[model samples]
Target: MKRKLLGVLLALALVTGLAPTVQAKTVPAGQTVGTVLFYVTDKAGERVLVSQVPVSEMVSDLKAGKVDNTLHNYSILDRYVTTVHQEAKGFTIPEFVTYAKEKSAQAALRAMELTFAGQDAIRLWEIDQTGFDDLDTYTCDELYGVARYNYPLLYKYWDYRTQEYADPDGKLTRDQAVSEILKSAEPEVPLLSVLAFSQRYMITDGKYGTGDYNMESLWYTSGLMDSERTPRFMKPMTKEDLTGKASTAADSRYWVATLLLNMKDAPEVTALGAVGVPSAVMTEDGANYYVRFSCPTQGAAIYYNHNLISPSYTPTSRYTGDAVVIPKTNFPGGTVTMTCRAVKDGWTDAGVQTLTLTSSGAEKGWISPYKDVTAGVWSYEAVGYVTQNKIMGGTAKTDFSPNAPMTRAALALALYHMAGSPKVSSGTGFADVPSGASYASAVAWASQNGVVNGTASGGFSPEAGITREQLAAMFYRYAKNVAKTDLTVSRDLSVYTDYADAGSWAKEGLSWAVGAGLVNGTSATELSPKGPATRAQTAAMLQRLGLFVG
Candidate 1:
C-alpha cells in the first residue's frame, strides 16, 4: 500500500510539474525529475518557485506529510492539494502552479477587494500591469490607485447629484467629498495631486450631471439685494427691486447675462459705459441688429450697433475683438449713398452715408444710416443714431473731427454735452481759467461728474493738448470714478515698464493706462506718453473704457 500510494503521488507530481522531490519511491514509468516543476505565487501575484526535486523525493516528503506542512507556510498549495487528491488524473500542472501561487490571505483579500471595485479594478489592473511609460496609457485604476477604492461613496455622490430620488442635501459637502476621496489614496499621494488622474478616470465632475440648480443659484443670491456686491458666475437676478443692496434692476442682469453668455456658449457682447433701453435685439424681417444707447459723458448719447450676421462674444469668436461688420444690402449701389454734409450737433463731415429706407421700409433690417468725415474718412454709421440725437459738434464746427487730438478742455466739453448740457453755476474760482472762458461750464460739470480735476491749484489747463498716454489715464480715471474734475495728481510714473521715461505731465495717467492694457508701447519699452494722441488709439482706449467707439 505504501508503494502504491508513493507511485500515485510520484505520477501526479510528474504530470503536474508540482513538487519534484520525493523519498526513494516508485516513479511514473516515463516521467523524470527534469519534467516536474513546482511554482507558487506571492501575495502580490508574483510567481515564486519551491524546490524542483525528483518525483521520488516528492513522494517521500508527501508520505511523511511534509508537503502538507510546507503548504501550511505557503497556504496557496492547500486547496490545490485537495483538488489533486480528488482528481489527480486530470489536474493540469499550470493550474496546480497557479493555485499554489495564490496561497496567501493577502492575495485572497486583494482579489476580493478588486472584485468589489469592478470596472475601477479592471482599469487599475490594466494600468498597473502594463509597462507603458506614458501616463495617458494608464487605466483609471492605475492612475488613481487606492484613491478610487471606495465604490460606495463614489456611488453615493453620483446619486446625490443625479437621479430623481436622490438626497437633496447629501451632495458631498466640498470637505466631505474631498476628505473621503483623499482617504482612499495611498499615504504618499498628495491631496488634489490626483486631479489629472481623476480627470482621466472621469471621476467627480465626469460623466455625472452638473450641480443642482439650487447650488448654482447661490452665485446670484449672495448679494441678491446689492447688485454691486454680487459675485461673478451667479444665477440670474430679478429686475431692479432693491436686494437690500444699492442696485438698479439693470445692473445685476447685465452682469448675470454676461456670465451666462460666457458659461453657456460663447462670450457675451456686453455694452459698457451707461446701459440704456432696447434691452434686447430687434429683428426686421430676416435680419437682426442689437442696438443700445450709452453715455460716455454726463449728457452725451453714444449708440452701439451690432449685427446678427454672426453672433459671438468670446475672445476666440469673431464678435469679441475690435473688428466690426456693418451689414448692408448693397454697397454704393443700394439705397445707401456716400455724401459729405453737416450732421450731428457739434460735427460736420466730408464723407457720410444716408439710407433711403428707414426702420419702417420694405427692405427689412434697415436703420437710418449716416456717416462721419470731419477728422478724416471713417465710418460713422454705427454712431449715427446717438450723435444725431445729441449735438456732438462743439460750438464752432458743425463737423466732428474723428482724428483730432483732444484737449483737456475739449473732453470736458464733450462730457458736459453727454450730461444733457446741464446749466452750470460757475464761479467756482478756478485759478487758471478766467471767469469767461468758453469751457468753464464744461469744466465745472466735469468736476461735478468726477471726470476731471484741475491740473494745478484750482486752475484748469483747458488749452493743454491731451497726449495718448494722458488721455488713456483720463479715461481710466473717468471709468474708475477717481478724478474729481481733471486735477488728477501726478505720481512718479516709474511703475510702468514701458514708459519709464514718460514726462511728468502725463506720467501718472500713462502708467495707469498702460497697466490697464489701454496702450501698447511705440517700441519694445517706450510709451512716449508726451507724444500727441492719435484718433485710432483714443477711440480704442475709449472703447475699452465703455466710452464712444467708431
Candidate 2:
C-alpha cells in the first residue's frame, strides 16, 4: 500500500510538471529517475542550481525527513520547473532514468560544487557570455553551468592581477574568496541611511500592509526609496533659506525705519545728539549685516531693549567712528544712552540714563524734589557730594527732609555706607538694638570698630537725637579706628563762653572738631554742644570727613 501511494503521488507530481526530469535509457541497479538540473538567480544576481539531488535520492530524503517541504515540496518544484522553462527555452524533460548510482552521486556532488561556488565561495561572481553571445539554442542551465565553472578561475586570475576581487571579473583563489566572504558577508549600510529607512518604512501600525500611508511603497515609486531622501543626506540650507535678504532699496529702507522705531521704543536707550537714520554693512561672506547708529556723545551705554550691552554713561575713548553698533540681542527694540551735564560747579548732573525696555516699563533714577536745596545754597555742595556718593538717601523717595533732626542710628548707617558697609555677623552690643532693625548691622559694626559706645543703660538709644558733641565724639573714634589718626586740639576754644559747660567726654571731641576746622560756633561766646545735629549739618560734616578719611 505504501508503494502504491508513492507511485500515485509521483504520477500526480509528473502530471503537474513538478517531478524531476530523467533521461530515456536503461536504468542502472539501485538508481532511480528524478534528478533535474536548472539555474536560478540568487539575491546577489549570481546563478545557482535549484536542487542538487538525484530523483531517487530526493524521494528517499523527502520520506526520511532529510529534505523538508520547503526545499522539496511539489509546489516549489512546479514553480522551479516553470521558471526554468520560461527563462531557458527548448529545455526537455526525459521519460526514463539512466546512469549508475555512483555516477548520479558524483553529479549531485558536482552540482553542489557549482551552487557553493556561485553563491558563497567567491566574493563576487558573474556570467561570462563573451564567446556564446550569438548562441540561442543552448539551455539556460547549460549556460549557467558554463559560467559557474569558469567563474572561480576567472575570478582567481583577476584577483591575482588587480587585487580587487570585489568586482565581478576580478580574480581570486578559492581560499581568498572564502576569506573575503568570511570577513564580510554583506555590504555595510550607512548609519544615516538605516535611520532614515527605519523612520520612514518601519511603521508600527499594519506593518508591510498596502495602503495610502505605506511609506515604503510610496517612497519606492517616488524614486526616494533610499536614505538620500533624508535631510541630513541632502544639501544643507543656507541662511537665506531661513530668512531672506532685503533685495530692493525700498525694502532696505523699510527695515531701517523699523529698526529705528524699535530703537526709539526701547526704554533703556536714550538717543543722544542727532541720531540719524541707522545703516548697515553687508559683508562679502553673506554674514548678517552689521548695523550702525550715530550718537552725539562718545561715552554712553548702548542697549538692545532691556539688556545692557554697555554699562556706563560713557562710550570708549578709542571709538572714533561716526556711528556705534546698535547693541542688540535676540529681543526686540534698541537703546542708546542720553546724558546731561550740569553747567554749575556744585550741582550734580546725577548721570542718570533712561531705559526703555521692550516688555517691561521704563526705568529712571530717583529725582529728589527738595526744592529748597538748590545749587547756590550753603548746604547744596555738601548734600550733593554725600548723595552722589550714595552715602545717604532721602527720607522719602523724593523728599530729602534736610532740616529733620539726625538720629544716632541714621548717623551710624551713613558712616557705615561711607566705610563701604562691611559685613557684620550679629547685632550691636546693646540690649535695645534688635537684630531685624535697619541700623542693627551698622551699630554692630560701629561698636566692633570702637566707633561708637552704648549708653550707661546698656542700650544703643538708636532713636535718640544725636547731639553735635556726641556726633563729634563718634567721628573722633571713627577717625582713630579707620583713619589711624588721633586728633590734637590746636584751635583755641576759649572764645566760647559756653565751651567750659561741655562734658569732659565731649570736650576733647569738640576741641578736635575745632582744630580740624570741621565745626563752627553760632557765636564767638557759644559752643552748642548739646544742640541736636540736623540732617543738613550731618551731610556737611560727612563731606568734610570724606576728605580727611581717605
Candidate 3:
C-alpha cells in the first residue's frame, strides 16, 4: 500500500509535471514576501482585476483553502511558482540564460517553474523573437517582468457578492456563447464599477431565467460614495433586485454582465509642453512622441489605463515606475503592464491597466458600461434628474453608467444636451476632432461659446476625462455666458484646507464653484478641486447648478 501510494504521488508529479506544493518555510507575521497582482482580460480586452495581495497573504489564503487550488491543466509555460526567496528555491532571473545554455526548452521551462513559482517575474511569451511556438530559444538576459497566476474566477461562485442564487451566465441551458461578465474582485484599492447591460434579466424559465445578476455569470464592484450609505452589493438577475434576492432560497437562474473599473481618474501621460502625444508607442526610444505622465496635481482622480510602460522610463519593479501617457494604444497580442495610482489627500487608490502593445498595434477596453443605477446609491437621484431631463444619456440603451468618469467628449455632449442639443455647422477645427464626429458640433459650439479651449496641442481630447477644477471652469463659463447667472463669490478658497493645491489655471473657477455652492468641499477644509468627476458627481453638480441658474 505504501509502495502504491508513493507510486501514485510520483506518477501524479510526472504526468502533471506542475503540482502544488505545501509551503516548507514559515512566514513571519506581518512580513510581506512580495506584492503580487492577479487579474485577467476578456476577449473584448476589458479588464477584470481579481486581487492585489502580498505573497504572504496569498500563501495564507491558499493554505486556508480560500482561493483556487485547482490542478494545472494548461501547458508548463502557464505554471507559476508556489514560493520565492533564497532559502526557498533561490531561482533568479539570470537562471533563464543559464538554463537555456544547459538544456532544451522543456527542461529550462520546467526548471523555471520549479525555481520561480511564486516570484513576481515569471512570464511565458506567445513566441520568442525567433518565431517558435513557445520560449524554446529564450533570448532576453533577464526576465524582469510579472508572472504568477492565482485565478479568482476559474471556479464557481465561491465568493460572489452576498447572494444565494443561481449564477448569471446561461439562458435555456443553451450552448449559446452568450457573453458573461462575472467580476467579484476585492482589490486593495477602492473602485467604483459601473455595469452596463444590454437588457435587464428576468427568469423566463429555470434554465432560461431572466435576472439582473450573479458571479457564476455576473460581475460586481465597489468604491467612492459620499451620500446615504448602506450595505454595498452586486445584484444577480431575477424577478427582484440583487439587494432583495439575498434570502430567497434555491435560486435556479443565472444572468450575465461585465466588470469594468472606472479608469477616468487613472494616471495619464502626455507630451510635456505640447498638447498632443502619440497614443501608441511602437519604439523603445519614444521617437513617435514624448509620452510623459505627470503626478496628479491636486489629488485628482486619474484612472488606471492599461499597465503599459513608458518606452523610456524603466521601473525597478513590474508596475512601480511609469505609465502610458496617451489615452490608449490599441495594438494586438503583446501585453505591457504597470501600476497606476491616484492620490486624494494622504490616501492612495491603486488601479491596474494591463495595456497590451505590439509592434503590430493594440486596442483599449475599460468600459464597465452603464445603467447600474440602483437605489440607496448616492448618485440615484442625480442620475434620474439627468436622464429625465434629457441632459445626458447612458453609454448604451440600458446602461446609465454612474461611476464611470465623465469624459471630455461626454461632458461636452452633456453641456450640449443641457443647451438643448443645438445645431451647429462648422467643424471643430482641431485635427483630432474629426469634421463629422458626433462631438464636432458640440466642440464647435463650446469653443465658440468660450466654454472650452482645445488642449495645448490645439485639439479637443474628446475621450479624455476632465478634472473637477476643469469641470468647474467649464461650468463657470457656461453659467456666466450661457446660463446668464450671477458671478458673485460667496466664499473664498482660503476657507478650504488644501487651497494651495489648486492649479493657477483652475483657481478662479474652483473658487467661484465653492463660493456659489456649485461644488462643495470634499471635507470640512479640503476641496478636491483637481479630482476627476464621475458621471454621478457631474450629474449632481449639474442638478445643483440648476438651483442658481434657474
What tens-digit string does per-residue lDDT give for candidate 2 at 295-354? 232211122111133222221111112122233452223433322111101111122223
Q: What RMSD, rounded to one decimal, does every model reach?
A: 32.2, 41.3, 25.9
Backbone clashes under 3 angstroms, per model: 47, 19, 48
**Candidate 3, 437-534: lDDT as tens digits:** 87788888888888887777778888888888889988888877887765643344564557888888878788667655568667655688778898
Question: Cα miss at 387, model 2 (Å)?
Answer: 0.9
> How well does candidate 1 score on lDDT at residue 338?
16
lDDT of each: 0.31, 0.39, 0.39
Pick the lDDT winner: 3
**Deviating ranges (above 4 Å) for candidate 3:** 1-371
Give each model a TM-score.
0.33, 0.33, 0.34
Selected candidate, larger lDDT, 1 vs 2: 2
Cα lDDT of model 1 by residue, 265-296, tens digit: 21122211222221112123333222222222
Report the Cα lDDT for residue 119, model 3. Answer: 27
> Which parts of model 2 have CA positions greater than 4 angstroms off?
1-372
